[model samples]
Target: MTTTVAEELRRRELERYILEMEWEEQIRTRQAEKHFKLVEDVFRQHLGEAERMTIRQLITGAAANGRCEAMVYSFPARCCTDGGRAIEKNLPHWQKTLQGNAKELYHVFTETAKPQRYGLRAAVVDFAEGFPAEIGFFVTWEPLFFRSDESIY
Candidate 1:
């Protein structure tokens, strides 16, 4: 049987396409493995120590930048009860949607930062497919100026 040049080209093209797909799948598998490994490491770490280190870093970075507020932490929106809708909308009860480390961080903020006049704010920081993808917790401090009722001469 005689093979035409067009047939040879088609065969080569199909083989190339298959190789490219295999390469892409390998890359994706490697990325997934790395992600899972990192997640495992996070889960094995000390929670309180991690929280304290994060808080320290946030404070130090904010002071160095001469800023009163900084994003202290972020997490995937899937961890939230409403997938971060409450945070995106700035609702009062957004904290109730927090889960896992995000919730623990909020409690730490209330117990430690709040009493020290630091305000905590949660907001949706990223979106995917028109939905919240990640939520960020910001620690803020701004002095309150009280207006006096007395008239000035």
Candidate 2:
């Protein structure tokens, strides 16, 4: 009086698929170029070109810069579930959508980085000095709950 193994396997398969949400590992990888591209697109939606760029070399172009940006975002994504939105101003919903691994992605530009890090860019130097007041304000000063209010400064 032995239970048939084939029936047990089929039953188990059905039970597992029906009852379990297969856990997937969304191990985060930061693609900084895409992030910057999104920001660029977003900024373009809001502002015109503040500066113009010419690609003298195809071997080196926006993609190279994006590769650098990717490195910046990938250093450690401890803050955000995704890079599309950020979570500094109590905007936790914009946090890592997965609910645990998201991190503030601003360090990619703000930190006084060295070659050992992301290498210093002469073009980006000025952008860093004016950060908290200029660029940083946009990221750090907004509050999450009051969508219409500009309460922080």
Residues 3-113, candidate 1, lDDT per residue (tens digit)?
999999999999999986665555444433433332234323335666655655565455444455678688999999999999999898998999998897677667655
TM-score of each: 0.59, 0.18
Where is the poorest 10-residue window by lDDT in model 1? 144-153
lDDT of 2 by residue, 21-122 (tens): 321111011222323344443333333354211111211233333233211122222222442233323344543232221122333323322212332211
Candidate number of the best lDDT: 1
Deviation (Å) of 114 in candidate 1: 0.4
Which residue runs of candidate 1 sit more than 4 Å off their true CA positions? 1-51, 143-153
Q: Model 2: what TM-score?
A: 0.18
In model 2, what lDDT does residue 145 have? 27
What value does the lDDT take at residue 31 in candidate 1?
Answer: 38
